[model samples]
Target: MEAWIRLSIFVAVLALMLVWEAKRPKRSGRVNRWHRWRSHLGLIVTSSVLMRLVVPLGLTGIALWASEHDWGAFNQFELPLWLAVMVSMIALDLVLYWQHRLFHRVPWLWRLHRVHHADPDFDVTTGVRFHPIEMILSLAIKAATILILGVPATAVLIFEIILNACSLFNHGNVQLPTKLEAGVRKVLITQELHRIHHSSVKRETNSNYGFSVVWWDWLFGSYTDQSRAGSDNVDIGLREFREEQRNTPFWTLLLLPFKDK
Candidate 1:
């Protein structure tokens, strides 16, 4: 039931992004949407299957186990359920912020993380393009966080769903009015902010690492206001993935993390 609800939101957000991008693209003709979507969608499907099979006991189950065993911080405390839920969600986001940073800074992990930055374009589909290994490792880390923090299953589900929805929104090519974007980004990561993370320039690539909440980047001094290159001129994707055909097929994306740059 939880999986179904998340899946439903994912599909709805994807559909909305596809239509919105068609009407107001951030960059003109940067993406071969047909080819890229196939590969990105393939990555999503592959990662989802691998995670379901390998990590059958997801965060909610972990949360339940931890609660029943009284095995975590919140379980040990006498806080209100609402307070527990809110604190857990905020703390989880902080953990994810550092997790994303470590993936970028660490060599072995960067090899997998780069598969995501290796795309030639940014869009809603690009949001779901992660290597199976990265996804599994992320799942493990999240499970550990849930256990340590005693995050409720409902809060975990809410975080997961919001992460999915926000990633799609921030990765989409849909352009928002400048004023509107400025306001929205104050609370959530807007597409403009996320696009900087996908820039070909190494400096821009390392900045704005936040996924859902932009506050982490702002507080960590990694907040980048714009692409070093102008929005229209910003080159998307990693510098090494210059070959246009690298992202066209599903198999290529699967093997990408192992390929030499």
Candidate 2:
């Protein structure tokens, strides 16, 4: 059921991307690098499948291993199902908010995270362009969260769905009316807010790091409410990475954190 939902969302996002690209004005005079776009699309599809399989498997394996050792901590938690789901989602988002901020603040982690930032274009595909290594690290974080917080698997599933859905929505190219965007931005992260994070300016790129809720950015003082340069006027890609490295294959992207770029 989860897999089907994911697939449906992916297809819808791809269709949206096509429309966005088609409607985008050519006045900026920047040529649409079709080959690079295709490569990025391929990476998104591949990484989505890999992450969907690996993350759940990794979590389940850890759960089974802990069960064998009589570490029944997750089962021991007696919270009501609804409370468990709500608390787990909130707790996970809090952790993710800080973790994402850390990736920008800490240079070492930024090396790994820069792969996602190196895209010269920002669209729906950009949301899923994370390195596989980063996904593995995220899974480790999830395992730790489950062990420490005793989060139910069902809550984890719900959070995953919410996270994925919001990611696609924010990275998407859909435009919203100014008043509507302002209202939504108060509670949720919107495309306008997230697009600023992809701006060429380091200051803008560092703000609005929340994956779903906008509250974290507000609470942490990372919130930037201003609109960015129009998508065409905005520059993407990291200053530290070479242009050639931006198109590196999956294996190279996986090993980028260790390599001296």
Candidate 3:
């Protein structure tokens, strides 16, 4: 039932974004959307299958198990349910923020993560493009965080939903009005900020690492307010992945981490 709810929401948000981008696309004419969507959708499907096979219990299950055994910090104390839920969600977000940073800072992990950055264009589909190995490792990290924090199952469900929704929202090719976007960026990561993260320039690529909230990037000093070439003109994707054939294929994306690029 929980899985169904998440899936339903995911489909709804993705469909909405698809239409939004179609009408108010931030940039276009770079690559064939059909080709890019094929690879992006393939990565998402492949990673989802691998996750089900490897972590069958999922993050919320881990939280429920911890609660049953009284095995984690929240369970060990007498905190209010609301307090526990709020803290757990914040902590989970913080952990993921660092996890994203580590993936970029570490050379080997970057190989897998670059599968995401290698998308020649950014859109709603690009939000779901992640290497299977990276998704598995992310699942492990999230599960461990849930266990240690004694996050309530409800909180885990909420956090996962918000996280997934934010990924699609921030990565949307549709942009907000400048004034509204400026205000939005003060809170959540807007598409403009995330777009800079996909810039081919190393400096821009390394900044704006937060996936949901903008606070982490600002607090950690990784924030880049604007792209060097301006938001619309910022060169997307890695320099090494300039050729469309090199980056936009299902098999190529799966084998990308092992390649010498």
RMSD list, candidates in order: 1.3, 3.7, 1.1
Q: Please provide, for model 2 over 1-261, each residue's C-alpha lDDT reduced to its tens digit, 9 standing for 90 to 100.
A: 656665677677667765774585222322244554566566666666676677655454554454455454455655687986788789989999988988888888888788788766666666877776677677778788777766766777667777877887787656667789889999999887888887768999999999999999998899988746764466666656645554555565566677676
Which prediction has more favorable lDDT, 1 or 2?
1
The better-scoring model by TM-score among 2 and 3 is 3
User: What are the runs in model 1 whose C-alpha is more than 4 Å off?
Assistant: 244-247
Listed per model in order, the count of residue pairs whose N, CA or C atoms clash below 3 Å is 0, 0, 0
lDDT of 3 by residue, 109-175 (tens): 9999999998888899989999999999999999998888799999999998999899999999989
Q: List the global CA lDDT of all models.
A: 0.86, 0.71, 0.90
Strongest candidate by TM-score: 3
Q: Give the TM-score ranking, best first.
A: 3, 1, 2
lDDT of 1 at 108: 91
- Residue 5: error of model 3 in Å? 0.7
